[model samples]
Target: MLSVLTLNVQAAALPRARRLLAWLDARDDNLIILTETSNGPGTAYLLEQCRAAGLDVTHTPSPDGDRGCAIVSRLPTTARPDLLAGVTLPGRAVAVTVNTESAITVLGLYVPSSDRAPAKVAKKRAFLTSVIDGLRGLTEGQRAHLIVGGDYNVISRNHRPRYPGFLSFEYEFLDALEQLDLADAHQRLHPTTQAHSWIGRGGNGYRFDYLHTGAALTPHLASCDYLHQPRDRQLSDHAAVAATLRLTVDHRTAVSAPLAEAAALS
Candidate 1:
C-alpha cells in the first residue's frame, strides 16, 4: 500500500511543522506534498526529520521566499518537470515522479488566488492553463500513473464569490482536469458529501484542497479523503488530503538535476 498526503502547511508555522513531522514519523505515508512552506528554519528542521525517517525530499522555492512546495517520499523520487510552460510565480508548484513498486507522477500545487489586480489574475490563469496543457501532453504520449493534489484556490462549483474563491474561469480550468479523465478521488469516494477543507470567517467553509488521479489509477485507489484533525486543532488552516493506492513495482530511476537537486536524504 502506498499512502500519499498533501497539505498547505500555512507559511512554516513552527509548532505546526513540528507536529506535522511527528505525525508523519508515526505514519508510513510513502509520499507527502506540502505547499506554502515559506522557506524558513522550521521547514528546514522538518526536512531534517524527513531525512532521518528515510524520505527523499525535493523543493521549489518561491522567488520571494514566502511560499514554496515540497515533495517527500519514502521511495525514490526524480524530478519530473514544472507544470508551468511560461513564467510563473515560484514555489507555488512542484512535480516529481516516484519510482517504487510502480512509477507514479505526482504534482503538488498551490494555485494563486485571483482576488488581486488584473496582472496577477492573468498570471494565475496562465499558470492554470499551463498545468492543463502539461497534463494533456503527458496523457497524449506516455501514460503514467498521475496524481496532482494541493490547494487549488478554487471550489468544485461555479457559484459567484459568495464566500472566498474563484468564480468562472478558475472553475472551468479545474473542470478541464475531469475532461482529461482525472477523477477527483475524494469526490469520487464521497459523492454528495459537502466536506470543506478550509474554514472562512463567520464559519463558512471551502474545499480548496483536492487530489485528482488519472483514470488508470482509480482501481488501485483504496482511499482518498481529508484529514481535518490538524485543521480543527489549529495546527494549520488547511486540512491535509490523503490517498492510498496499491502498487506492484519496486525499482529506482535517475532524474534530471533541475527536477531533483539532492539525493534521497538518509
Candidate 2:
C-alpha cells in the first residue's frame, strides 16, 4: 500500500514549520504534498529541513514569492516539466511521477480562492478549466495512476460553502473533472460521511482540501481520511488529508527501495 498525504502549511511560518517538521518526521507516508508555501527564508528553511529528514522534495515558488506548492516523496520522484503551465494564477502547481509499485503522477495544487472581483473570478474559472484539459492530455497515452490533491477552494451540491465561496463556472469545471475519470477518494470510501477540512468565516466549515484519484485505481484504494488534529491544535488552518492505495505489482516498472518497503509494510 502507498500512503499519500496533503496539507496546506499556511504561508510556511517558522512556528508552523517546526510543527510540520515534527509531525512529518513522526509519520512514514510514501509521499506528501504541500500548498500555500512561500519563497521566504522561513519556507526555504522548512523545505531544507524536509530534505534533511530524508525526503526527496520538489517545489515551485510563486511568481511573487509566496503561495507556492511542493511535493515530497520517500520514493524517487521526477518532476514532470510538461505539466508546468500557466493554469495556476500567481502560485504554481507541481507534478511529479513517483517510481513506486506503479508510476503514479501526483499533482500538488492550490486553486485560486474565490473573490468578489470579476477579474479574480474569471481567473479562477480559467485555471480550473485549464487544469481539466491538462489532466486529459497527460493521461492520453499512459497507463500510470494519477493522484491529485490540495486546496481546491470549491464546493459541490452536497458540500455547501459558508457563503458564496464557489461560483457556477467553478462548479461546472469540477463537473468536467469526471470526464477525466477522477473520483474523490474520501467520498468514494464513505459516501455519506460529512467532514470539513477548513473553517471559514463565522465558523462555517468547508472541505476545501481533497484527494482525487483516477477511477481506474478505485479497486486499489484502501482508505482516505482527514487528520484534523493539526488544525484543531492550530498547527495550520487546514487539516491534513491522507489516502492509501494498494497498487498491483504488475503495473510497476521502476520501484524504489522506500516504495518497496512501503508496500511490504502494508
Candidate 3:
C-alpha cells in the first residue's frame, strides 16, 4: 500500500529539525510532504538526512526569508517543476511524479498565512488563485493521478466553531478545489467527524491542513487521519495528516541524489 503523510515543519531551526528527522525516520510512509520549509540550516539538515537514508528528496528552496515545501519519497520520482511554474510563490508548491505501480503526481503546497493586513491578504489571495489556475490547467488524465496536500491556512466553510475574519476568497479556494474534482480525502472518510490540525492561543481549533485526492484516485483512499504526536511533543505547532492508499509501489527502482549534491541545493 502507498502510505502518504504531510506535515508543516514550522520552519524549524537546526535543533528541532534534528528531532523532527528522528521522528520521521521511524515512520514507514512511502511519501512525505513537508511544508513551511526554508533555505536554512534546519531544512538543509533534514533533506540531507533523508538522502542519507536512501530516500529520494525533491525540494526547491524558498527565496531568502520565504517558506516553501519539500517531498521525500521511498520510490523513484521525477520533479515536475512545470506544473506550478505560474504560481505566485513558486517555491511554496512542488510537484513530483512518483514511479509507483500506477504513476501518481503528488503536489506539496504551503499556502501563505494572512491576517487583516491588506498586503498579506492580497498575497494570500493571489497565491490561492494561482493554485486554482494551475490545477485547472491539468488535463483530465493528469488530474486523475494527482494528490495535493499541505497547510492551506484556511478553514472550510462548514468547519465547526466557525472562526470569523476569513474572507470570501479563502473559502472560494476550497470550493474551487472541489469544483476541479479534488475530493477532501479526510472528509470523505469521516464526513461528520470533527478534527483540527492547528490550535490557537485561545484554545480554538482550526482545520488548516488537508489532503485532497483527485476523483479517480479517491476510490483507492483506504484511510486518512490526523496524528497529534508531532504537536503534542512540540515538534511543530501543526499536526500531521497521514493517508493510506490501496495502491502499490514498484520496489524495483528507488532513486535518490547524492548527499553532497542534495545538501548543496538545499
Candidate 4:
C-alpha cells in the first residue's frame, strides 16, 4: 500500500524540529507532506535529517519571513517545480511526481491564512486564485494521477458549527478543486463522520487539513483518516492526516536502509 501523511508543523523551531524528526523516524509512511514550514534553522534541520535518513526530500524555502511546505518521500520522486510556477507564493507549494507502479504527482500546499485585514485578505485570495490557475495548466494525464494535500485553513461549506468570518472566495477554492475532478479522500471514506484537525482557542474544532485525490486515483483510495497523536503529544497544534492507496512502489528503490542503519548507530 502507498501510505501518505500530511501535517502542519507550525513553523517549528530547532528544538521542536528535533522532536518532530524523532517522531518521523518512528513512522513508516511512504510519503509525508509538512506544511507551515519556514526558511529557518528548524525546517533546515528537519529536512537535513530526512535526507540523512536516505529519504528523497523536496522543499522550496520560503522568503525570509514567509511560511511554506515540504515533501519527504521514501519512494523515488522527481521534483516538478514548474507545475506551480504561476503560484503567488511558489515556496508554499511543492510538487513532485512519485515513481510508483502508476506515477502519481503529489502537490503539497500551505495556503496562506488571513484575517479581517484588507491586505491579508487580498493576498490570500490571490494565492488561492493562482493555485487554481496552476492546476488548470496541468495536462489531463497529470491531473488524473494527482494528489493534493495540505493545511488549507478554510473549512468546507457544510462545516459543522459554521465558524464565522470566512470569505466566499475561500470556500470557492475547494469548489474549484472539485470542478477540476479532485475528491476529498477523507470525506469519501467517512462521509458521516466529523473530525477536526485543528482546535481553536475557544474550544471549537476545525478540519483545516485535507488530502484530495484525482478522479482516476480516488477509486484506489483504501483509507483516509486523521491522526491526533501529534497534536496530543504537542508535536504540532494540528492533527496529521493519513491516506492509504492500493498501490505499490519499488521496494528496491524505497529508502529503508539508511533509517535502519541510523537506528543501529544509535
What TM-score would every model get versus the actual structure?
0.86, 0.87, 0.94, 0.96
Per-residue C-alpha lDDT of model 3 across residues 1-266, encoded as one tens digit per residue: 78899999999999898788768866768889999998888998998878876788899886666999999998889999999889999889999999887789999999999978999999999999999999999998999899999999988899987978999999999999999999999999999998899999999899999999988889999999999999999999999999999987665665433433434445
* lDDT of candidates 1 onward, in order: 0.73, 0.75, 0.89, 0.90
Clashes of 4: 0
State the lDDT at 27 in candidate 1: 55
Tens digits of per-residue lDDT, candidate 1, 25-93, equal 555567888877777877877776666555688886666764667888877888865444443654677
Worst 10 residues of 3 by lDDT: 255-264
Please list the residue runs of candidate 3 whose C-alpha ends up more than 4 Å from where it truly belongs after superposition: 254-266
Candidate 1 wrongly placed segments (more than 4 Å): 82-87, 141-144, 158-165, 249-266
The residue-level lDDT of candidate 1 at 71 comes to: 87
lDDT for 42 in candidate 4 is: 88
Model 2 residue 147 lDDT? 86
Model 2 residue 50 CA deviation (Å) reads 1.6
What's the TM for model 3? 0.94
On TM-score, the stronger of 2 and 4 is 4
Give the CA lDDT, 0 to 100, for residue 177 in model 3.
92
> What lDDT is obtained when candidate 1 is compared to the true structure?
0.73
